[model samples]
Target: MVVCFVCGNMTAGSNVTQLFSRSQRTQQTPFFPFLEYHDPAPGASPMGDDWSVDACFVCDALLAQQWESFERGRMPIGKRLYWLKRPSGCEIRQPVSQIELEEILNEHSRGNLDDYSDDEGGKSPESKPQDPPDDTPRLICYSCGKSDKDCPSMCPVHCKPSYEQLRTGVPYYPTVLDTDKSPGSKVVCESITFLCIGCLPKFPPEWHAVQKDFLRQESTQSVLPRIPLPEVVSCYTCGTDVST
Candidate 1:
């Protein structure tokens, strides 16, 4: 079994899409060409070193469809949102109210959405803005800077969320890269991102053929389509794998 870095879902090893840094890809799997740091996925900073990302079943298809675009120097990322069904209660994220969501969407559109909280300048608030209680920590996406988990108050992840993420509207989760038990794990805004769930992925008209192509991208042989496992979901929480 492997864990996907994008949506944090569990997948069988054979059904995964492994995106290696240029060097790693050339050395391990050369079936596909690799992209250099000079051009990373849209809105993401240059990947600094050799690293790899695992995409689960659904995310793999999404990537395969975009592989051609990547070759064209346009790497689209952090542009979609997915809802994970958590049957049991979630510990890290709380339901956000509609009003709070609007503030996150409309007001920040003109300015940098990722700039919602500027901590530098060491200035104090002129007046206490009407917000949820201060205990719940704040989380903003490094990509699109959209949805977040918070109490009517606040919430916190492995670490504090930051205000430096680029706005790509893609749901980014820093914790998704590692198991929740990994040390130094934290969910900072610069390391996380959330897109408005409203934006949907555009599936091609010949969707079934595309899905078949996706499942076989790594090899010519067809593999079973990967299904969502509600039993295991990486809660956008502190990057921990949560089993419902």
Candidate 2:
């Protein structure tokens, strides 16, 4: 199900999608669809890094106006538009004025922006937990987006990855519970591991056997530890160039 990030109006239908340049051409008549937000990598195509957001048609139009007014000719829809700052010198990474959008849509569209809302049947909303504002990279539960702040007792579980990726980068992340701890059998001394919160109870049991087969395919694979372990073999003599 697609949900409008601004007004919180969700629909069962697929979202509308169009190119960035095309939307620029139809400035006054921007396509009103559930747009997807993307922060293009640095040095992407020209104008690719412009700040954009995923919003419904109504919200997108509002965002477009705000963007064009502030940026003159640019529409803040699918780019990294700005690096907002606060009075105390703390930087804020607000992609757009989401609060204003909520206020505007409160009287127009479905303004049920609460992600944790429940239905009349007492069922929880399908919305996923939103990430906290602090952007510092850290391990989080793969199932639920909980961090050490909430799920302090997380476990480390490795998920099997393509034979190629296994050669590089540590895939270990924190999982909230032990059930979501481990996935496939150990492959390549180190591969991608999942840190879920009991969300996967024997979830990828199929991978257990698949990884076993990987063992046969390759006998020896290098292990790349995410955190370096204490040196097992160090120079016995201080700064020795040759062993005597």
Candidate 3:
């Protein structure tokens, strides 16, 4: 059994059954559309029955609901969080802690969240500032650099957890895309980006490419430097075969 990415529990009950059935609708189901890369090889065998993810049943259910809410404009898409029942049956929506959130925002705004997470643990003690209290004024949205209060009522997906994200968070994995490489090439982000369900397709489809370098562009942020590709053949850590 795979652990759910959001609630960190084994997906149980009807959630598992329904998710598995939906996956069966296609040989290789597209659960995370934004992360999709690597076109199927010429005459590659169709994928068999396999439905795997790290989200619990409850969290998956919430994600399904959020997709509908986003399409209908009933809720701010990826900008907000939703409540979920953990495996222990606790109902909650957990956001990044204020201190952690500040660190994330600062690092990402500097275009180096991935670098920081890679080379060190957050910021240095002297560099780290005190987190703002709950009542503090909001910063501009990371994607648009506009105040949600002043801007039109559009979904606000921040680079990191802002006050609004604390109220309406969702789980996401970090990834990078190579807009400059040959078709069907991309790289997983060295940094993690926790995103809400509705923001899955947030990136422009035209921008992704399968390439040797890792590239990324968020909302309106300028693209970061290209990262070198990882070794193919077999991942020494995960033992999964990787082909280029």
Indicate which candidate wins on lDDT.
2
Candidate 2 residues 1-244, lDDT tens each? 4444334454343562222322333244332222223332222221223323333465555555654564444333333243221123223234367765343323212322232234555476578988889854355655655655666665555554444434443232222233333333222345444344554453443234445567569567798878755545456777544423
Better of 1 and 3 by TM-score: 1
Residue 223, candidate 3: C-alpha displacement in angstroms = 97
lDDT of each: 0.39, 0.41, 0.37
**If scored against the real structure, what TM-score would every candidate get?**
0.21, 0.18, 0.20
| Full-model lDDT, candidate 1 | 0.39
Highest-TM-score candidate:
1
Ranking by TM-score: 1, 3, 2
Cα lDDT tens digits for candidate 3, 54-133 = 44456566666755554355332224344444334323333347665444324322442343232456545456677876
User: Candidate order by lDDT, highest to lowest?
Assistant: 2, 1, 3
User: How much RMSD separates candidate 1 from the native structure?
Assistant: 35.3
Candidate 1, residues 42-113, lDDT tens digits: the string is 222333345556556786666555544443442222222223222233233332565653443343233333
Candidate 2 stretches with Cα past 4 Å from truth are 1-137, 161-193, 207-244
